[model samples]
Target: MALLYNHLRDARIEWNRHQPQGGETEDEAEARAAAYNEKRRLKTVQSSRKSNKLNMRKKVAQKMVKLCFAKKDEEGVAAWTWFLKLLTELGNAGMSSEESEVGDMPTNSGALASVVVFAIRRCPWRLAMVNKYMEQIDEAALVVLTSGHSKHARVRTEQESEKFPPSGLPRAMYNPAWLTVQKTFLPDIEEILNFSEGSFTMMEVEVVIPGVN
Candidate 1:
């Protein structure tokens, strides 16, 4: 994943270097950058298809969640919550009611499932609040985490004959395996949850400004 990220970063830098910069106005520079970024996005999509790499945004989001959870602080919780909401909103966008059914398989469901699994694995203490937020979005986040593997299996079976499947498998499908691995070092979820609870506190304060009250 690091190799893939470095490759994409280098590609973007090369694109920027080749962009016309001779007496260009701010608007022109912005437009050129936007166009270059779109081209880079398409290149990334093609590269991912060819190499079976996960999308950079999703990979980074997952890593960010891991890092935030590792901190186990109030600020980390806030950041994780924000990212979870963003992922859920992104997954829910353009989804149909029927497609959102419990048994129905949606192409974008992986994003939400990934968020749920991360919460389960890293922030189980906040699972209740996570579920409440998911309800606001009309998603059964826990259900998705529990049942996503079967859905992914079905999709894989349906596309068994294809050279490349249309959608990548949900990261949630590997949660069980991850849990098994985690047990070697962190064997007690309850202990982790208790430790997290003791690690962070939220407080409110008033700020005074020099120019304004």
Candidate 2:
């Protein structure tokens, strides 16, 4: 849970931690250091090996360039175009320690709709974007994001699709957003996760629209 100190416009964070009391003399600490070094030498070598592999992964990501574009009202062509560019940047940073939080409407797309409404009422772009897009989306090319928890065994099932008939099983949350979706077809909630984004997580969503609209 998160709380906001409205007056300060800041969020208060709570977490559990263990505190350490310090009272070690320099000589006492030095004596332990020598023994620690002997044990740490091999561990350091192994850690470096892991770091090397991560570096290689980063290099591999640099070569991948998947560009997906969403068309908005002609006025928002640029914003839609920018969204695709942003995805490419995120792909490049795949090796970094950035974590995304995705939310699903498993409990109720209505609840998800409520959150969307709240966001739109407070900041309306594609005010009714989700419902609107889901009403018309293609499920075939849809990407899915599943829960990280093992309750579902880390698999994102296709439960039911709203987009098109063929879709990927659940994976993990990607990013969702309010798009200038036209009324054509509907995709399953799971299949359309990649189409939206609230900082790269499926659960956390953000819908965009033209500034003037």
Candidate 3:
């Protein structure tokens, strides 16, 4: 959330700096000012939407974590299955957005990835339990990779391709390697487990552990 705030702040500052200054004709200055304001407005709307989506994901992830600690045996597995279904729903919501056409991939991808990793990390048994959801995971991963939002997509895909070499799934959808790379850059599952309320700010997390990004 802090990262989003900082990004929005930086964007506003950049736009303000680019605002028309002295020596420009009234018409030129007016047009430039209008453009700046419009762009800024659009960016604010985008940021707000992204923030809301992320908050929803965080809430869902927190619930899943709680279930992991609270439930046991068949009951635990059943609860996890339900929560995983919720994640699938969330991911589908993200994918259905028209914004993806404009370079705005689903903000929930990271959250979905995080929750899945958290489950696997905390409970090795979840690996087998989640095997049924592999298709959904692969789909979400494809969205992330093709959206061009992942910094390590190319390199990660290349590495995974050499190992598994892409059979039924796209090379980039290899869940283990994809999750590993996301975990490398994203906030730690332990930190997320500690979250009681409110959003987890990527900037704040990165600050606590310098050089992770």
Candidate 4:
């Protein structure tokens, strides 16, 4: 009899846990349940965001592989166009890394180090293009730095505009001021240019260290 009474008491307690409390009206019970569900929903969203952050490096690496290894020609208009596209993608990927960091955004130095390491792994041969793109970024960053505004139309005269190549795309399309993953990883950019196509294996080991970012 005691065991059956205890079982009944436990079942009653379990039922009451989900039911409205002694003084709670139907409206009050509904509001309380809604608040709890909202909290659970917010927690789910936060968990998903954290998961995305953890996967960022893997995602960026895969994208770099796709960009670097495709069968595009190595010279002329096709190559130039492909190279430009690759640069834009690299900058975008780096920007994504920055977005993960949120409140305390990393400096270009740290973020660039991480991205340069990633770039070298996926596409060492075209890594040299980083220098050219960096120059374009420097031009754009200069304009923004000096002017105190974000507008892009300040490139004065026709002669002065000659700094950007006629055949090339705009600095905005290429360097994109927000891409701190680095338009150019400064220290290694010149060194990367010196790597012979076959010599990258040894040089990569020396230059691409882990965890710099």
Each model's lDDT comes to 0.37, 0.29, 0.37, 0.35
Residue 111 deviation, candidate 1, in Å?
23
Give TM-scores for every candidate, taking all chains together and pairing residue i with residue i: 0.19, 0.19, 0.28, 0.25
For model 1, residues 1-213, the per-residue Cα lDDT tens digits are: 999999999999876755668988767887888877787886565444323212222333444455546765556445545544444432321111111113332346553332111111122212233323323322222122333222322111111111111222222311244446556877873244232222222223221211222
Where does candidate 3 stray beyond 4 Å? 1-23, 65-213
Model 3 C-alpha lDDT per residue in residues 41-142, reported as the tens digit of each score: 865664564454434443443443454455443443454345454444333212111122222223455432211110111112122223333323333343
What ranges in model 1 sit over 4 Å off? 1-20, 53-213
Q: After superposition, how far is residue 213 of candidate 1 from its true place, in Å?
A: 77
Q: What ranges in model 4 sit over 4 Å off? A: 1-18, 62-213
Instruction: Write down the RMSD of candidate 2 (Cα, Å).
Output: 21.0
CA error at residue 197 for candidate 2, angstroms: 15
User: Which scores higher on TM-score, 2 or 3?
Assistant: 3
Model 4: lDDT to the true structure = 0.35
Clashes of 2: 25
